[model samples]
Target: MDYLLTCDCGRKHTVSRKQADQLIECSCGQSLRVPTLRGLAKLPPATEGADSPPGDTAASTISKNGENPWSGWRGPCMAAACGGLIVSLAFASWYLLQRVSIDTSYTTEMEIAEGNKIFDLYTPEDMSLVWHSFESLGIGAKEPPLFIRWNRYAEDRARRASIAGGIAAACGIAAAGIWLSSRRRV
Candidate 1:
């Protein structure tokens, strides 16, 4: 059997069972007594709050393959990122749909406003001519027209939101794929 010895210089050395209790020169030039395996086993087990020897801790006890047992979070983090992106995309899509409806309604209102010459681009006498022109064009409507401006702001917002949604969707798909691949490897 092999006995483990820890030197005050923070070095660990393994000695034969027969050499237990014998003084041996450590690589750091210190003469240390080798600990017997039986005595080491007789030592009380470490508790959560108990003080550990130098160079040994609760983290060191659970290491495997030179890695901490709690170090694998890439897959979970990526999945969370993907979920967030999907939620953002859904909101963007809903906003885009709402903008489209607003744009259509605004456009129809602008057409009616043009038929009424609401911008004062013509004289009062020309307003009659404009109404005649609308009638000639088969757009006759007795409803008074409005002076509405195009909703360029909503249009621009919808455009930007669509682009953002598309990019987010792409990133979410890529993240999902990466997360799934990593899961398979684990």
Candidate 2:
């Protein structure tokens, strides 16, 4: 016979006769032991460990023995996926923006010294190409892209973006590994 022992965590568990006098600990995780069937449950055994085999009993995964904070949280379980997405997005965004400025600078420099013979520096976003071309045609006001805006802020932004991307990758990997953990028993 199993007596239901109610724990302070509003959780009740079943105590087998063998485990009764054995100073059975409550599954509620409380650090206290009380003898009684006040608020406990005796839902059959759910594992298939031959010795404790009691047929197939639907055991609650939530009540399993574990100390995971994100045990039942979907966010933590899928954190890796989210982190990977963020890293990819940030990298792509920053790359595109950086490329635009880089291309503009290289081309402008080549055109100034090489005269019309410069690298292909153009983009098809919101007339970025046209603006650059038009601005390049001006006299005395045609400042090279590098000398215009190249400083610590830009480098810092790039570094921070990379750091964020790296963090995201790490998070993604962690989440993936945990999410794919096998439920296959030992």
TM-scores, in order shown?
A: 0.37, 0.31
| Residue pairs with backbone atoms closer than 3 Å in model 1 (clashes) | none
| lDDT tens readout by residue for model 1, 1-186 | 333556787765555555556677766778876556677564344333332222333323333334433346754667677886887787788777777666446466567677567647778788788778878898655653342333665667688788878878876877877666554542
lDDT of 2: 0.48
Q: Could you give candidate 2's per-residue lDDT for residues 73-123 as a string of tens digits? A: 644557657767676767757854774454224344554666433323333
Worst 10 residues of 2 by lDDT: 49-58
